[model samples]
Target: MSDPKTEEDIFAEVDAEIAAEEEAAAAEMDEPIGPSDSAVDGPGAGVDALVAERDELQDRLMRALAEAENIRKRGERDRREAEQYGGSKLARDMLPVFDNLRRALDAIDEPSRDVAGGVIEGVELTLRELLNVFGKHGIRPIAPEVGDVFDPQLHQAMFEAPVPNVPKGCIVQVMVEGFELHDRLLRPAQVGVSSTPAS
Candidate 1:
């Protein structure tokens, strides 16, 4: 009051107040006051918290997008498989009719083919049309010829026999033709194979 406080005294008083406030804060937090700790209380703290939240949200959004893409790709693959193989059962059932048609033609011997020429021609036409349809639909016949190497994957051995001049494991006769749908085997060709050659 007698003399206005000197600049030095004024600064000392302000510093004391700030130190007291810091002491109280440190006491409440159970830690020592430091420059770095003080910085965490200002406007910068809100910005840091907001930045952390933004990063977490961004991570979650990215993960969700990746999961959605994977689900879409899986669904597309399932749809394609269903489209390609949906008629497998129907195609399997129709094979018997094809076999019957083949039997009908084979029953007509060459000696009587001329006598029943018109009927035989009609049957032949039907067989040709059926085969054409089979080809168009990705169904192919596996008609292994005699002397072809026997393939266990594509042929079923009906029996094995020794044959002169024929290599072992070669086809001796094709008992029945097989069929395939796309890359899958609908039926394996039935065949007889040559046994091991005599020593």
Candidate 2:
């Protein structure tokens, strides 16, 4: 009563059954494994956690090294600054003594100059020794002489004096000698600037 199937039909049916069986087997194999089947947590998971911890520790170590380098650079800068300006207060205090020495030298006049020669020589020698000491410490005097052009940066004009021979704005007198430490002016020279003679 049933009709005989063709070869093509038989082959198609067999292929379909085979394909269905293969798909079912693949699905079974792809199913998620239970915790019991998984060996990850049983053996190598602790090693993976330790690796992660090592990476974090390495990051922290690099940050700490950078911070230490910054601190070292800051300390070096502070030390250099301290060395450069260490004697500022002492230099300021010694300025009055230099002024006194200059005043003593100026007090000796022509008539009394012969009588005060020995005292003046001693004072001059003391001043020269003091200046030598300053030179050793990188301090230099900046006293502008008469007929020198007035410079506002180095000279502070106390007053303007009329002098016939010198040009206007020229330095006529130095009231106090200035000083420099390295390239920076520690004090400006106190000076009397010359003006045109009164008409």
Best by lDDT: 1
- Over the stretch 1-199, how does candidate 1's per-residue lDDT look in tens digits? 5985654565466556555655564465565558786676763454455456556755675686679789999999999878877778988898888889898988889878979899899989998999999888889999999999999999999999989888899999997889999998998999999998766
| Cα distance off (Å), candidate 1, residue 159 | 1.6
| Candidate 2 C-alpha error for residue 197, in Å | 8.7
Write one digit per residue (lDDT tens) for candidate 2, span 1-199. 8886654565566556555655664565467867775554444454455456555755675686679789999999999877877887788788889999989888878877788788778999999999998888888999789889999999999999898867899998888999988777888999999888766
Judging by TM-score against the true structure, name the best candidate.
1
Candidate 1 C-alpha error for residue 174, in Å: 0.6
RMSD (Å) of each candidate, 1 decimal = 17.2, 22.5
TM-score of each: 0.73, 0.64
Indicate the worst ten consecutive residues by lDDT in candidate 1: 42-51
